[model samples]
Target: MSQILKLFNFIRIFWFLILPLVCFGQEKEKPRLELGGAFRVNYVYSSWKEEQKTKGGEFGYDMFRINAKASYKNIFLNAEYRLYSEAFGGGFLKQGWVGYKFNKKDELHAGLVYVPFGIKQYNSHNWFFNITYYVGLEDDHDMGLKYLHTGDKWDYAFAFLKNAEELNFGGGVENSSSRYSYDVVGRNKETNQFNGKVVRKLGQHIKHRIGFSGQYGSLYNIDTNKNGHHYALGLHYEMNWKNWNLKTEAITVSHAPENAPGESNKIIKMGAYGTPYEVASDFNMYTAAVSKKISVNWGPISQIEVYNDFGYMQKKEKEFTDSFQNVTGLLVTAGQVYTYIDYAAGYNHSWLGGNFVDDFSAGNPDAKWEARFNINIGYYF
Candidate 1:
């Protein structure tokens, strides 16, 4: 066989020259690849004095944020970038898939992960939006594939998401029949849904989390039904003692039932005159949050938080001209607290009308009261 393939490529080039420099001279020097990331630029002069102007009405420029993250050994990476000030923005991505210690316990991850689902709210984007920003149904970043198990007390996880999507609180992106606008959910590229989730833990504190995801696809310009689906449910809790800490969470969302019929009739005709009648989209969402911690001093100090969030939606029965009911409330925040160095300031408000309880209220009329004010900073590793 050609002399045994030339003696196996001459012993694989002498075993890559002394086995990688003798394993880097018996390894014991790591920490040169340290290049963390975080940058912020704020300077805003607010407006939209609550009265009426739904989603983030109008506020000038003065918000720039950039964050970078990395870790070695098992594996970790993070990235969040934002730039808003009349331009609007979106950013949030925390990843980890550390697996290899398949003996001591267990681990495995694939793309964009954060499994505990809730009740670990500390720096949830600068202390839960300083007391209001529709919590819960707003975590879980997509692109999934996870599995982790640890024993001593308990810890487990299971997730599988292909193309899940979510974003609300006046910032429309509805599902179950279509309600996308924010530039068509950011330039509609397409790939609707497919989701999954599962978490369980007991003793030594407390834990339990759940999740479900689904997305069929089809959405371009109303064609009497182009496919749809969406669903989720959750529950979580935590406890601690010494300094003191507590947490809570809940979530639910449903969608799937729309084939386009007797509603949504695209409009146009500037040359003549005839356009006004298109709003068929169903909705449903419920969220929650709670936090606590106090024991002040200086170095290892405390004096933490308490939070809230709620969302109820309805507009089925062939969704007659969308926008029926939406109630969002998140109030309760204290100033200045720390854990990993993060200065703070906050305010977020939301309230829109319409609802007759599964009867789908009378359509539209009463749209206003949207507020937001945030000053945040953080440094954690």
Candidate 2:
């Protein structure tokens, strides 16, 4: 309770400080404010383990998100709050930030923002992105301060973050209840981090981005105190021609204990499955996707896109086998709404970048292939 109060107080103070600056402008121009949001729902069908199988279809709320933005001259504030049925009856602060633009080429921001690692955007066209996104290596948000620079041919960002996933004032055992839970994993604790990325545009049809990301923290073990570290190097490429788009990225992530015995090992929970397993210290991941947009003149159907996304993870260990996932889908968009239908098939477990699932039972290995069909519809207002 005390920690919650402290978090609330911090936000309140920040709000008060920014309110005066935004309200008392040098010019008479009124500040601009915009309110928008989105609602999403999904229907899913999956073949569970033979013993757990059932014939009934499943439907549920996907998400409800609200976005707010306010700007006055060069200072601006942006925030997003979301509610999810799978988030265990709690809301999430996806993004909340304040920024000031120094010029066209430079800007600074402070608050919770996406980490600068791997590909800057979604690595796949499907609703479930590449495996890297599941393990806090890609498309993950963190509380931090970031500086960005944009030039005629290049772009770069540098950031320093406290904690990996979200801001938690009440620090105790890390939580791992739902997919939307922001707590750091037990084996990979990201206390503080320095992340950087750079992109170079070579031509109108092709471009490249390379990034180096690293984090230093400690493992979340109540019995033993051990420091852990994470490092990754990634290369991303994109090509565009007419209505076709191609994107790919390859990243290598290494996680290890800073100081520990030679035989020290810990059982950690996998993010997607929430099952405990031992993992190797190193792994590699690759992802690729291609999409084509077809223009349409039909009523309420401006465009249709077809895409196939693939992801692979290779773990450098004898105890674990590699895993991969493939998603093929179509996206239809009209005005402020879009719908997606996709089929995903994977082996062993969800592609978790370097994170791998262990054998669940002697006869029933978790590495068995599984498939799921999903349809999602969303509207923006």
Candidate 3:
């Protein structure tokens, strides 16, 4: 851990030292450097099963991030450093990339960046994101090289990513279950991965965007000395008009097991909660959200946004019941600050951390609802 801290400090010092030079040393023709970040705090309450209810509210600093970007002619550098309270993680580099522009509409980048999957921007209004996020398939980032192109009516991105989502250099116990971290399990010793997405817009007042994404890679099972295939396909759509926005996505992911009968379900280990658990080989998820923005000037609030989000997950095996989650929230923005208050409920099972369905189920197959209340405040600079 000390070594990791030292490395982090070095990177921090290096960036801080170079930022001033990049901002002022360039000629006037060069684009000016941009700096921004946000600080957030949250309070949470959960009332699930009798034993899992929160007696007192959980409150603390959520996260803080610093963003820096600069452009010298067509060459650009962008980076962000994130610090989270103990509950999330100590600190980490969320994004750090350097890119070169080939033209006004095309650019190439290398380093740690977001994977090209699902919705690119504003997919969910909730802080936990959608179900895809819990399944290690949504809004995820990785180390890779990427190519991006933006057009008047269309946009596309393609990337080559490392088999392992994030690099772990300290040789410590890997947090296999945490949604914030990544680990390869089962016979699938991940190799290389290819991901790409394309989006096209249609209509005018009721503008719409549709996207398709796919990923493929190889996996190995060490116990049997066998290899298999890992792949996923996703479809997403978004529509906006006046003051309302709607988004939806569906994804199918599979991990083929070596030597397993084609008609039988393959058992595989997946990351969840802070550890890994075994589940069927194939999983499918569907999510949708609708939000309405209202411009208002009441007290210190200048705008109010209300949204409802829903997600459903289906496991290949019938023994394990499916899961569903829904969230309704209101976001109020005042100047550079915003506050979000939400009520979330889940049934059968959910990936949203606080759900206590497993504890209450007690071998019962029937679904029960688990609920939580969350409030978060953030300030941007």
Candidate 4:
């Protein structure tokens, strides 16, 4: 009779689509689920007649990073994976996110995150009480959408971005057969990036933070089709005492090239072409650290650390030999934190560029004096 009326209309549309998920799982009650993870294994020996030789020194395993987080209530999830060796395998760009929580702690995030804009342990090192020469700051991470607010002492974050895809530090084999060679030097693929921040906690161990960030598009060089418009501005500060900690950060960058070309301007002009082109640059950083906590007999273990870091770069390149006006770095770290081992030693005095140090000769190689030593063993679940 019409095949039993099409099987009774497919069982009444599958019971009207599971009847509102069984009455919303019996009118839900709470306590969704939770899980967490963390792991890091490192041991490094250093060398840098100018850069690149920490693959292993008298030993190996420069670094290792892994992280995970999950929650269900107002919805949440997070990820982190990092490693500096083995040919960049787990170097998956460092983060991933999904969030929602407008109550238990105000959060509303969305994928490929972290534009929180600075000063959370120098842009965060997956937080486990980080202290590695406290390298001033500038670990800009992008690809974002965020809004986070937390309280007890006030915290805030705001973001909007997409200016990734650059990190090739030019090595010349024709700039390594150019494919944009990882393009990073105030990268801006097309405009569209934003940032915000605020943090306060004073009178209980002091804390204060401020932020503003930037990036704007237009920088085309599709084989010299030339174009312009670039920008950046930043400020940051942090302080703590009891064992002591202090920080400072500053940045100002500009590149306004539009029709730039000249031997005395016959046509193109916009900050007038200067070699590899980066008409202006400025970056400054400062750091300080002091630690104390020692109670022995193999119980409360150890905590002995010392720190220092200062990195500065100010250039106005027009190829005055690739302009590197002020480049500096001075780092010193001493560590011994134990429940089960975490030893460190660093003697880094700067002059190598960008991703800190993996050595592709980015700081353009003119300054010298390098040192690094590391050790780690971690466990927490």
Candidate 5:
């Protein structure tokens, strides 16, 4: 009942705050609203599947999404909602936020927004992302306020995320984490996370972005009635020269959960998309990727991007096994159409055929290498 009340109150406050903006009470140069979305499908062939070699693979609908962006002068609203099949955890909002721009260089965002950590936009070229993503360290989103500043050579971002996305959207199993972006869920919930990141851009023709990110957050263990701590530090680098791009990053994360008596503290529970998993308490991760773009005049297609991404995760405990993932992929871009073809392989990875819950914690040391061939095609409007 209390949680329900809190949700109601949050909705009320949000509506009240946004009501004035909707009315456009003040002077405005006409509000602009833009609606766009994507329809995507996927094909996959996994090595671990018994019928993969014979049946070839499976092809099915991947997702359908709707994105909205409306701006009235300095204030704007951005949101994206996605729908997936029931087996894949059903529907959820990817991200939604309201923003006020103070100036060309400064802005503030409120509501459920992306966490400013590690690399901007994405840490990998392929769809599966990197190991840090599965662990909720990359491309994560939460509910709170964020401040950003973009200078000529230096860019800064600071955010205070109160919590992850609420579990009160769409229809799903009770307490099910069927949503976008990996987050701490179940009994141990994430709260009051503080993130700071800074980047320096160097050179004009051969562009470069060097950045560092750090975050500290709390985990509220419902059973313990106390707060645990989670901290991470990241070093990132990206360089673009002509049609070639390079990205590299290193991150170290530690999670100390205040668990119930006799419960294991070596691993903490984190989850997403209707599944809960255990992650190692302390680990170091690293990734490197390179891509090249080539122009083609084949009908509607205009460009092709080929890339390879590699990531590795090493646990602090000697008994725990490490994780590795590598993806070689190419992206084809046409008018309002995009296609991605990838060959991804992993050993002891959460999404690449390893045990879902224990892959990031005490993973099997003798895990065999598994490969997945995937193709994702989408149309945007």
Candidate 6:
């Protein structure tokens, strides 16, 4: 009698739960399609190099990219691919995700999707981005499934990422890990990661968003045949006051890798753009950016934005040197043509002039400052 009653109660509860979802899935809706892409070029002047200053810098082709989005009823898709010079990383998929909308405020996403951390879209105002970018925490993505809930004044996302996107299905390793976005690669790999983010908005005219993010993952050592761990916590803030915008965030990251004998655990290897480099295993990062839009009528140009972005990384080891980056720039919008002109400066930074792998790792305590003047122009369609 007791077993029969339990089975009857379970069936009754499932009937009510499954019937509505089955009915909603049957509703007919029109399909939608959208496709877009962009072409961009860059001119850069490296102040740290003597020849660049003497020859007036170099102008070169940057990249071309394609983006697509489609929807059929509650099911939707988004994908993007980019082609860069061979010296950069060749061709790669920036993002490709399939989603299902549970309702107006809830959705589910799967595949290579952005990790919900720090700020939503970005945490920097310049082309150089922030310090967290180099260490593989900001604007990072992975193969994962995500659940999102967006309320009027609150947004929440949770994800479980299996690993980084692999360029080939060799089931082993590739000679080149060239791809977009930083990830744990080389002798070590990332797996079984969980991420969560929550944000709440306040104020009306002077709006502010306070958010928090958390992550935990496993670091698999191919050689050691053991697993280490990594985790990060971040606090994010954003403000919008009329024409001004602000974004700021502080984060602490720790990675403990099971390295082989004679290997140092203070740093781990990360790879992207066909290159692998060492990054400090533990550090605190901070970033802040502010921008203001000015309406103007200058020929085809209608509006321009003036902004500054700053990033800093402080290694917890105390023996390791710190890194700093700052960029001030203007973005001009003229119909389909958008342009960015900026000057970026940094100390103990990789892209800015300090040694690539060493700068973000132990770093050179006596490293001098390096600067770059850059202009990027792109056409969107």
Which numbered prediction scores highest in TM-score against the true structure?
5
lDDT of 1 by residue, 160-267 (tens): 644323333232233211111111122121233333333344444444333232223333323332444434454544444443334443444343434345542221
Residue 248 in model 6: shift from native, Å? 1.0
| Candidate 5: C-alpha lDDT | 0.86
Best by lDDT: 5
Clashing pairs in 5: none
Q: What is the lDDT of residue 44 in candidate 5?
A: 96
RMSD from true fold, candidate 1: 22.6
The residue-level lDDT of candidate 2 at 125 comes to 77
Q: Give the TM-score of candidate 1.
A: 0.25
Tell me the TM-score of each prediction against the true structure.
Answer: 0.25, 0.82, 0.84, 0.26, 0.92, 0.91
Worst-scoring 10-residue span by lDDT in model 4 = 266-275
Question: Please, what are the lDDT tens digits per residue for candidate 3 over residues 188-264?
Answer: 45556798899998889899999998988766554455667778898999999999999999988887756434433
Give the per-residue lDDT digits (tens) of candidate 2, residues 284-363.
Answer: 78888889999998999999999998887777654656667788998999899988988877765533222234521111
Computed on alpha carbons, the lDDT of every model, listed in order, comes to 0.34, 0.66, 0.71, 0.41, 0.86, 0.85
Model 1 off-target regions past 4 Å? Answer: 1-68, 77-365, 368-381
Sort by TM-score, top down from the best: 5, 6, 3, 2, 4, 1
Model 4 lDDT tens row, 319-357: 322212111111222233222222222222222222333
Error of 1 at 292 (Å): 44
- The sequence of per-residue lDDT tens digits that candidate 6 reaches over residues 256-345 is 999889989999878777677888899999999999999999999999999999999999988999989999999999999999999999
Residue 224 shift from truth in candidate 1, angstroms: 46
Report per-prediction Cα RMSD to one decimal. Answer: 22.6, 4.8, 4.2, 22.8, 4.5, 10.7
Between candidates 1 and 4, name the one with more favorable lDDT. Answer: 4
Backbone steric clashes in candidate 4, count: 4
